[model samples]
Target chain A: MVDKKQALLLEDFDIEIVSRDLNFYYGDNQALFGISVGMPAKQVTALIGPSGCGKSTFLRTLNRMNDIIPGARVEGQVLISGKDIYQHGTDVVKLRRKVGMVFQKSNPFPKSIFENVAYGPRIHGTRDRQQLAAIVEKSLVRAGLWEEVKDRLNDNALGLSGGQQQRLCIARALAVDPQILLMDEPASALDPKSTARVEDLIGELRELYTIVIVTHNMQQAARVSDFTAFFYEGALVEFNATKLIFTNPKEKQTEDYITGRFG
Target chain B: MSGSFSENLIYGLLRAITYAIVLLVGYILFDIVIKGLPVLNWEFVSGYPHQSGASGGILPAIAGTFYLVLGTISVALPLGVGSAIYLSEYAFQGKFTTIIRMAIITLAGVPSIVYGLFGLGLFVLFFRFGASILSGSLTLACMVLPTIIVASEEALRAVPKGYREASLALGATKWETIRTNVLPYSLSGMITGSILGVGRAAGETAPILLTVAAFFLPKLPNSIFDQVMALPYHLYILATQHPDAEKVRPMQYGTALVLLLLVLGLSLGAIFIRAHYRKKYKW
Candidate 1:
């Protein structure tokens, strides 16, 4: 654990999320240790690591999805847009609405495609059919799925292909009009074609949403992200520009892991 | 000793055992239908009894059975399903929840005659509701409560956890998620369970015998307080307790057939609902 703290020099680009010494635990087992990183606004920051390296755990901390697990606890601060979300009396529902999330496997509700996209607005007290329709359409279009699924909006969302279902989940998260989007291996389960489609969709979504994606594919990290953070054994090993992390030297562990010598 | 020959023998034995059970059921049904069909006329159904259920229709018994089923369901459905939702959605894993689950299982195993005695002591004596529809319905509801809760809870549990997570992640409150997503998918299961409970409630003679059933009141009940003739109790009296039980054999068969049909009808309806839901949500 010596020389473990090597801070990345965050340049003047606006930071959308800041984690100061975040530690997370599930019961007695700790999963993340003193992870500190700044994700710049409107740019995709990819968290890449070997399996069980706490990248997904860190990703879930941003939206507080880890709160669902029993005996799961978090220490330290997670600030989004300058507000400390872990502070007491913070409305978690409001926080989730602001910081939307897409999970590893696509989990569209067993509902119609239109309803899948419109679920968020409907629950937040939007009763008018017209407004819900408009929001659904806008979300689908932003997710790059509207033209493909416009005519069959009433069809069961489970009937969609794997890639479409994943995109539908993204559209659902976007329908809430969140400032930040957290994706946990959003394309890991899809075919290559579907993965390409989702990657392209992520490229478009980055312009409006502050995207933080957790991926297993290093090539995917290089292709889609501006910044990359490498994690190993529940500690953040390196965080820098994707080009520098990929092309130049950093921590011996990161260079070794990324170069396929060992995970 | 050949493998295929032994496999064929096992298959044949299973088929024969299944056919034997089916044949027994068919024989009983055939006997009942043939014996009851001779007297099961419109007049026999609609007309009032002449001399202590010796002749005429079993209208009052039919009406009483209907009332008992209605009252039992009205009392049990909400209580059972509410407890089920609480158990499945809200109750934490602890000693208290375990106690509740154990109590429900124990209640399901209690004998119908014991339920009758309990109803006799509680609703008839302590509460002084006396021998009336209210007492009978309350007793039957208690008897069926465990069934409804178990079935409804199973249905609630069958709803995928992912659905609940998706709803909560979309900023829906826990109650809102349950109301919209959980309840809709589990409704068919709940209804099917309740229907099966209703069937059990209808056929239960011992509970109603002590609580509400009358041996010879061949008329419709005007109020919940009225003691009425129910099909199962009526059939029991005509079969065993009547002064001339040997002469009224046809009426006994008819009553038995009607009760069987009522229970079978409810069970079939539940089957239909289960099938419909299975088609709608394959996941």
Candidate 2:
């Protein structure tokens, strides 16, 4: 069953992450039910659904972020670069380094802006002062926050505006140089202008990295993603090109959700 | 109009009660200051007590109290903070953890005199350390351990979960995330909590009386094992045990005043440090 799904998903593009029949539970309450999907490399994939529909859970399982939650349990395989992440002896720290994440809310550490960006590289063993400085600059530039924050890199990160802080969080994630980025509603808390800026940033980032984003806004999914997966009630109702999912969804539930009929 | 009148009456009653409590505390402080000031010269502060503390300064008692506080801090802060980190960050929430939490809360309410007796049994008699500064400090540390642990755990929990998640998502290990993100932010709170413990340890007399206090040792301790004079015990002796307690009334008030000042100074210093760190880490 997994092999057939893999063949179908691998038909058009190179796959960076694939979860086969993934089931997740928190204690006795199941949150995800046999989810299978593939995210293409160097492309943006958006998971859209209503609140508590397990889009965020699926995103977190890619990097095992849910491991920190008490009683959270996952079954089936999450493959990153064709390696099953749940297998025995897999190093979670190394897995997370390869697949970084951005949370729904901006959560920069209470440190200097420079320190916030430098944190990832420092933890991964980049030690020289000059090397750290260069990494910090490159990450900030890539996140498109360097121009605004270059003069105040030493200021406390909490002092930044909300939108700027979100960008700084992106830069911090980028510093580790992950190949895949998992974002859980990265712009849901932002103003319209900031949201547009983040959407544009996402468009630019897809050229260099595989991005999987979970969002509730269908318009955001349509604007920023190449592929869209519509999740409802912990099940994937449809997965296809973003244009098809929006205009000609195969599943009735997908059409209903996309057309604002009912969640 | 009736509702407004009732509200105003309640508000006035509450304000009056608050002012009454304040006035009571102010009267006690005023009485102490008025009696303590005339005898609080350099001679009284720095000179050795003579004739069973009937006349002279309380330098030895001051030094002993300072040493006791230092020892309590050195012993309690690390143990308490470490336990707090384990409880808040690492420990799995289970029956075991719940029991541990219950034990800590119960320990916090246990009487200090009970701790004094425990110290007498464990450190003084069983360990055979005798009535010395080492025994007294160990006792005080045990007594304040619960307070520091409870406060430090509260501080650790007060930090937003987002910081830990952000650090972990950035590929940092659990300990590394805690070291960089959690501890630095919660440090001011932990220090503030520890200073409260230190204040309690410094002012406590019963624990030291059973474990280390010397009634008339008019000199500083030379070693941890040596008996030392403490402000509370000295004041207790001057107020009640001294043969000429009537003549030493001013000395008693002076010793009480000095001890109060020391505890207040320690708390104020900690408040300043906490404020500085709070400014640095606003989130």
Candidate 3:
């Protein structure tokens, strides 16, 4: 909700990805309305809202991933590293390279674990076998999945358990070396243990990359994110520091949502 | 549980009839294999067509069938799969595409004889291509095009929505996504359609007879215009024109066995392709 033009490297944190007046529509149905938020670098910004609140839609806008939907369209600027991603001639492939995403359900490609990790690099023209191997190893380690899956990298990713597959999907997204990661309810599909693992992974990732995650769990947003933006019915209800949003929120709706009164 | 003896008898009789039909088909297959087995030989399978009155090879006819099928595939594959992609992935769900899809299914159900007649009009007369292998293959292609298109479209349709979304989300262009992911993943199913098409093209006699108008030319065909000797036509000739010709009988029996083998081989190949992918793609 904050749109004040401040210096990129402010005292709180440097901005990485910024959205200005973003609106989304599916045919005549407006899903998101005038969502302007600045995401800080090397920190997690959680978007917490109730069902059908356009939180997912707003997360999809970061990487222009909504372009895949047949009837969906996004309006306004989504800037990554101060570059307008929606501008004409801005190669979406390159933009997505710099902005990775993970979905709610772990969607590992129907490929071997090695292939799943190497896919992004292959697409970006990395054919050197040793380099791909190194990247895969490093990414799996970064995603906290290397030791568990190291021996079975050639096996199909779908062969892994649900929790492990989610970690592998994270590693896949991380393989591209993106500066921004968009996670749309990434842990919602996992069990409590896997959810805690992903939350821990998020904690570590905030030291290196900007993260925008959409979650229905207010407790999760409070625990993992530095800043929280609460949405309701396609509108930004409140945006503030996560502790402030969860503890002493400005909006009554935010208080009710955090207190489990009317989620 | 039947209320009356008569009703129970009728139920038993109906079930017996179902078993009887299955047994009849099994017996036919048994008869064909038993009768045809003793005659099969390397000389019979690969040798040229002739010997005494009965002993000869059907090499030319076999080659004709092969070339005819290859030509049909060369022409039909791109058109069929492209149309399928357009219909399943690109074309909007509208009355036009729906009507076109319905028409294709209808074409598939039409008898081969009707397709032959239609081919006769289109290839032989309308285009004036004449009774050549090209026209024959074209007729056969049209006859099987519907099967290929429908099966492939179903395969394309069966691909989960997530795959398309994932590819597009990765910022791959639509065509590139389809080309690299969707097409490769459904190739086994597409192969099943194509193999079925080839089977029909290889065996169907009426369509080729009408479109190609097979002439008793002993030489090999060099072009589509050149009249070719397909196995189906040879069998037709051996059975009807020279029924008592003992020499042709062996060749005919040998050809029949080979035709059966061709169909079986195609089916096995399709199954193999599907199995290979099923094992390779678990995710």
lDDT of 2 at B111: 87
Local error of candidate 3 at B80, Å? Answer: 1.8
Q: Output the TM-score of candidate 2.
A: 0.97
Q: List the residue pairs that clash in candidate 1.
A: none
Give the per-residue lDDT digits (tens) of candidate 1, residues B179-207. Answer: 98898899899989899988978998889
lDDT value for candidate 3? 0.82
Model 3 CA deviation exceeding 4 Å by range = A1-11, B1-17, B51-55, B121-129, B213-215, B223-225, B243-253
TM score of chain A per candidate: 0.96, 0.96, 0.95
Q: Which candidate number maximizes DockQ? A: 2
In model 3 chain B, the worst 10-residue window by lDDT is B48-57
Lowest-sum lDDT 10-residue window in model 3 chain A: A1-10
Clashes of each: 0, 0, 3
Q: Considering TM-score, which of the candidate structures 2 and 3 is the better prediction for this target?
A: 2
Best by lDDT: 2
Model 1 chain B scores worst on lDDT over the 10 consecutive residues at B274-283
Q: Least accurate stretch of 10 residues (summed lDDT) in model 1 chain A?
A: A1-10
User: Which candidate should be chosen as best, given TM-score against the real structure?
Assistant: 2
Q: Calculate DockQ per candidate and list them.
A: 0.65, 0.82, 0.39
TM-scores, one per candidate: 0.94, 0.97, 0.90
The best-first sequence of candidates by TM-score reads: 2, 1, 3
